[model samples]
Target chain A: MRRVAIVQGEYHVVYQPGVVISTLLGSCVAACLQDPVARVGGMNHFLLGEPGADVPVNPADMQRYGVHAMELLINDLMKRGAQRSRLRGHLYGGANIVAGLGGIGTKNGQFARNFMRTEGIALDHCDLGGTQARKVEFMPYEGRVRATLVQDQPLPPVERPRPAPVAQPTGELELF
Target chain B: MPAASAIKVMVVDDQTSMRAMIRRALQDLGFKDIRDKAGPVEALAAIKADRVHLIISDYNMPDMDGLQFLEAVRQDPVIGKTVFIMLTGSADKEIVQKAAALGVNNYVVKPFAPAALKEKIERVFGELV
Candidate 1:
């Protein structure tokens, strides 16, 4: 099976049947889009939700943002002869791994949902918003998605020498 | 080059976890003065005030992507010579060539090990110890 790994801030569109596209997510969102009629599909992994109000935005950065990710993925699918009206979306990987960070994952998930609604695309499946990271794999032509949870790496155990056994004084005990 | 602890490094990423992960990795590698920013814009603002010796920035950010950020840095007079390492998930050859042309010192794909990060930095900055 041919497999392509999508990374953060990247998207891939596949026309070949049974080609698997995968990505690892930690507080990032990946949107899988497919049109069964044309047998074409694409996926995008985005790091941020949207530009904040009054914040500066560069057009080139749009591909890394959720709104742009969705747009790019859909456009690529359409370019491959997929019809927009028949597109189905599957969303995955928005986990709040960083504690006390104001819920970046939640914001990302919301943006994706809103974008799907606004574009009139059917969001059929989603695994989003939790403390656990995820691995997302999608077969665009088949429109099959599998999500697996990933746990954080634990620190390696430290090795320490056993303390030397205390020696008992034979003659007398001294008082401090 | 100076000791690893003496050099100042800045890490830019929109994801808090990414920033934290890089920071922890650097600390493990014996880098003492490490600063993290949420995006390229914030990193630029901080750079204007206090120049860092090295920058490890994520390719995708909200206000400015890594390419644009590298362009801005290259145009700057004060911090233009800072060592830069671009981090990304995709290893697109076109993007890599563009970054190399923009004066990026190195590139790292995601799911990398701390040892790999150390080796990459050492390739540009000499021995860590």
Candidate 2:
């Protein structure tokens, strides 16, 4: 069984992947975790590196930041019978799509890297930070991920534009 | 024309899936003569060649934009008198005014429910019934 989720805006979710926890990313980031031994895993998407001020969260906003999103994903796996020593992570999305954001994507990537290292989880593999939004399909059962990168701006009506060609750059935008 | 057969619709949008979705919604509402196009150019061709009674178009695209499409539709004598409806999320005053000037009958913004679209279509063409 496969399930898909489109993560955008002020949203946070937690799920145990009996199969997969799939999502897409723009200026956001998602951290995936798997307990190879326990065979338990899940993932999450957060809008920005810093969630900023004024947004109220259910439990607390302090632990809802970017750094904490990763921490939470990891800890969730551990709670599901994952040993900290055997847990592995894969990161996606921190694209420089929005130009002149003061290297916001780069900052997010660094935050994820530091958080992973600091938390003592061995970073098995990572594909992070680029200039494309990605559609990701993760198979927690077999620990496999299929990602699609759609390189086009969402033409929200406010920007009344012209006709367009349907040819899109579809490929493995990145692999890490 | 009677409301039962009063209006034919042309749905224009850049997203293939979204266009299909709008078409499905139109079908569910019993809108006959529902034709969909991905870009304004194709839509313009359809407008020029066909007897479209109404239009529902997405505002943002790469080729001919919604406003230009609407203008082209109005300029074409073949279907100039047909009503227009814009289904989009654009809040631009200039664009809206231009569409209004073109004699568009109605508009539906983005992130809308199917019932909302049905309501607008019903409102604009409701008297036909």
Index of the highest-lDDT prediction: 1
Badly placed stretches (over 4 Å) of model 1 are A153-176, B1-129
Which ranges in model 2 have alpha carbons more than 4 Å from their true place?
A1-176, B1-6, B127-129
lDDT string, candidate 2, A1-176, tens digits: 75656353222223345465677676566777677777776677665554322222322232334644554455446546666668777778777677877777677777667666755667777777788877776776576777778687451111111222233332211111
Candidate 2: Cα lDDT at A157: 19
TM-scores, each model vs. reference: 0.50, 0.44
Tens digit per residue, CA lDDT, model 2, B10-119: 88875554565577667666676788887888888777777687889877655677888888878877877777887544245566666787777777655344555665
Which predicted model would earn the best TM-score?
A: 1
> What DockQ number belongs to candidate 2?
0.01
Give the winner by DockQ. 1
**Cα-based lDDT at residue A81, candidate 2:** 67
- Candidate 2 similarity to native, TM-score: 0.44
Task: Indicate the worst ten consecutive residues by lDDT in candidate 1 chain A.
Answer: A155-164
